[model samples]
Target: MKNLLVTGYRMNELNIFDQKNKAIVYIKRAIAGRLAPLAEEGLEWVLTPGQFGVDLWACETVIDLKRERFPQLKLGIVTAYANPEEKWKEDKQNYYRNILKDADYYGAVSNRPYEGAWQFKARDELLFRKTDGILLFYDEEMGEASPKFVKERALKLADEEGYRYIAIGADEVQSMADEERLSSFD
Candidate 1:
């Protein structure tokens, strides 16, 4: 069995619940949700804060708990709110970038799918794509898909197109919707 990590929305501040204990409870629930299926499969699941809320303290607590409870689990990072619409808003680009650079694998959870986990951070992957430019338009009506599958397909296209960078934007998006990518399995 393989280990996996699933990420979602999270509020890192203790003030969100008016108590530190409440924050812990919220984190605990999130941890449980990821671990439940992994436990049944005898596979390990590691939980970390989604890109939306990379609470330093909360993140530390989750890591500490994982090390204490399941020291041998595999790790992955989750991305939230896949699109960037607000410039003033804090984006987890930095957080997601770190994970993509360092983690074994990553997944982006959104209405539509993306090509690579690194795309979430737009780090090395973008440079690798050799994109002339990235156009960010606010359609507010574009279709969305699974990040995991999308990323998987992107990688395949990269191999097929002999494009170490970017390839088959549409096909990769389709693969993600079809659930064809599995980076964790790699």
Candidate 2:
């Protein structure tokens, strides 16, 4: 019953448009496909930060996987602070809330409102401390609040803690989307 953590770029950073981006759909499918093997290997819980893009997509994928295959699998949404979605747009906030409602467990790393960068770092540390493995979706080229930064920090912590980690990069995601498109024509 191993626990895993998921981290990655937000929707804006990934340029995902309204959850309809073909690339995003392919990426989610690819991530879900990857998780199947891990679920078979012993994974039972997935912890997501409930952020947009990769984190949310991963959470949704885990939920679907749980329903279809891994009946024992569970999802946990960890927020950086109380009302972490306070600043998000209404639609985004609603989506986040819906996911949180469906999660098996939900908690805020900081009980208070978000203060500064330290809160985010603390949340990341907490997530790293709680999970046995990590799944990172990152692109080194996206330098604005890059997922690569978080992935690197998580990987460093995983190495220190002797936890397993897997990373899927932008190029690999593109390749997957291309393959999906090609296969669809068959």
What lDDT would candidate 1 get against the real structure? 0.38
Q: Tell me the tens digit of each residue's lDDT in model 2 across 88-137.
A: 88998888888887799999888999888887888888888889878888
Top candidate when judged by TM-score against the true structure? 2
How close to the true structure is residue 103 of candidate 1, measured as C-alpha lDDT? Answer: 46
Worst 10 residues of 2 by lDDT: 139-148
TM-score per model over all chains: 0.32, 0.91
Q: Estimate the lDDT of model 2.
A: 0.83
lDDT of each: 0.38, 0.83
Each candidate: RMSD: 14.6, 1.8
Q: Best by lDDT, which number?
A: 2
